[model samples]
Target: MRRHKEHSRRLPAGPRQTGPRALSGRLPGAVAVVAAAALALAGCSGSSSSSSSASATGSPQASGSPQVSGSPQASPTPGQQNGGTQLQDAYQTVIANVLPSVVQITTGESLGSGIVYDDKGDIVTNAHVVGTATTFTVTLANSTTALDATLVGSYPDSDLAVIKLSSPPSGLKPASFGDSSKVQLGQITLAMGSPLGLTSSVTQGIVSAVGRTVTEPQGPGSPGATIGNMVQTSAAINPGNSGGALTNLDSQVIGINTLAATEPQTNGAAAPGIGFAIPASTITNIANQLIKQGKVTNSGRAALGVTARTSFNQQFQPAGAVIVSVTPGGAAASAGLQAGDVITKIDDTQVDSLNALTTALASLTPGRNVTVTYTRGGTTKTVDVSLGELGTP
Candidate 1:
């Protein structure tokens, strides 16, 4: 089977996670990616990507940015003019409505995308985009004046964060968020963000799927990131596009552009047009909590209390998670799990890698006791463990 590799949008530390069973294939190693995800969680300083300043800002030029269709359109005949005009008008209207809400976010030297979340000047973006920086330089759509922003709250578990401008510039417009429950496959969507640091850039496509299960880098459990119920779109979500808006034709924000599919077989070549976004429902719920509480209270997610990395056995092939540091008195410890023990399975699932172990644990409830299988001194052992609620550290 081909290994499945999962990458967070862009962490500057490069992609991580290779599983023999991920996406029904092998994934990248977790040892490397988890470290990056950990640093992000710790709010450690990270160098920024290419910074962008506005060149010409009235509207994105037709030649430079992304659009609904990639093919060159044929000039409309007299008979087709009416329909073409209406479609053109529709595109323009949505663009005009959504543009004001999309902004370019710069932290330290890094650049990413954001959306004005409210009249209070609060902006929401990917947690990784903000990195460890609490302050930011924000460039509004169609405007080059960079404004100051401060972090409101961040929930890296969901890879989402909220920041508020120190002061709102005049004419700020809060974007209208739509019900993600209403989103359906084949619905047209425009991805508005600063891809590759190109401010106010837009790409268009249809909702390829809804409710996709994706595991990246962030969560309550150490070195684990899992975001289920994602919105999959064909729109291009490149570097700097993180934390931007994915909108429907009515100009309603439906999702936050997050990660794109990276194919490892072709030397980490990005799977063209295959991108994922955090659904608006998750974004709305998490961002609002972060804004109000400065932290998440109820993640409603399951987790184990162990921080682990992939380890190999004598065979030198993928074995399982080697307990790096077990949260003492946490789930694993309570179940008699210890460092140096190789956890080889949970319940009926075969744990082949760190990704597989986390995925298995995520599927179970915190308080539910399950059979844990592991290897110690080259001998196999099993124990029943009562899982614990995934709580903030």
Candidate 2:
């Protein structure tokens, strides 16, 4: 389907269409955000709202008449009384409890979703949803009033960010966060957000997978990075759904919807029933830091300390990572590494390309030291460097 972000910051291409990496639909004319996993993914920008069509009741009703059921109704069947009524009631209760916390975010020609993060007027959304703006216009659930908000901070590596309302809305209810560690496959979920600018919309599905090491392009024309321990779901994550809540039946925010599947080989056909989100455990930690410091000082994420790109050998096979620039006082710089060096491996893991390098590094935490193998001037070299923390204001 057609996805477009007509008036916002640049939209990144989602994962490669080969299912090795997928992009999500973002722009009014593009697919979702960039994604990786041998699984194609993208940022929200598609128009399809996924919902199971309700089956017809198969009974006729009187037109323009209030049918009063004064007569005693038949008791439900044993199966219906035990399973159907309980599930239906549970879903209704959760939806009612959670809808008030979801909100719509608009920034320069693009629209997306967010969730109320706290009673202090803080809101959590995707870094891309926050875009490059420090101020925003947010529409709360079931309300048309657009309130002013200020950006607290954003961390794109995990696709999470925080914004605060200028004036706290009275009776604001924050959604509770569930332990992502407790999330399991096949659990039911409700994806809430504004898709195509429709406020307070929801789609239902089940957890398709958990703890996936998924990566996406930071944005258009930037080096891609992984958002570790992702939550994959079958809920329809459409355009503008980014930063919205992937909630469990307990009305808890389990994840923040971020990416949708797109098949580029089919001219960017949206792959229904597949979407991704940033887990709540990561969201809580990053948001807390951003709100307090306006930047993350201890990201817990591993970084290479140098800008790098993939390079190939003479045989056109993936060889290693080529360093472009090293951060001053960073692990690579302290280790005396410089530009023009090709990294071939990290510890025992072979680094064949940029993606491989990202995967290897994501497996480690910040401050962890590992041996990096590289080739410079046709001479092989190794250096022990402590990985640095990523994330700036």
Residue 102 displacement in candidate 1 (angstroms): 0.9
Backbone clashes (count) for model 2:
44
Model 1: weakest 10-residue lDDT segment is 47-56
lDDT of 2 at 309: 86
What are the lDDT figures for the candidates, one per model?
Answer: 0.80, 0.81
Off by over 4 Å in 1: 1-86, 215-224, 265-269, 324-341, 361-372, 375-389
Tens-digit lDDT track of model 1 for 67-142? 4233356345675988888878888899999999999998766788999999889999888787777898899997
Question: How does each model score on TM-score?
Answer: 0.71, 0.77
lDDT of 2 by residue, 272-301 (tens): 887888889888989999999888877778
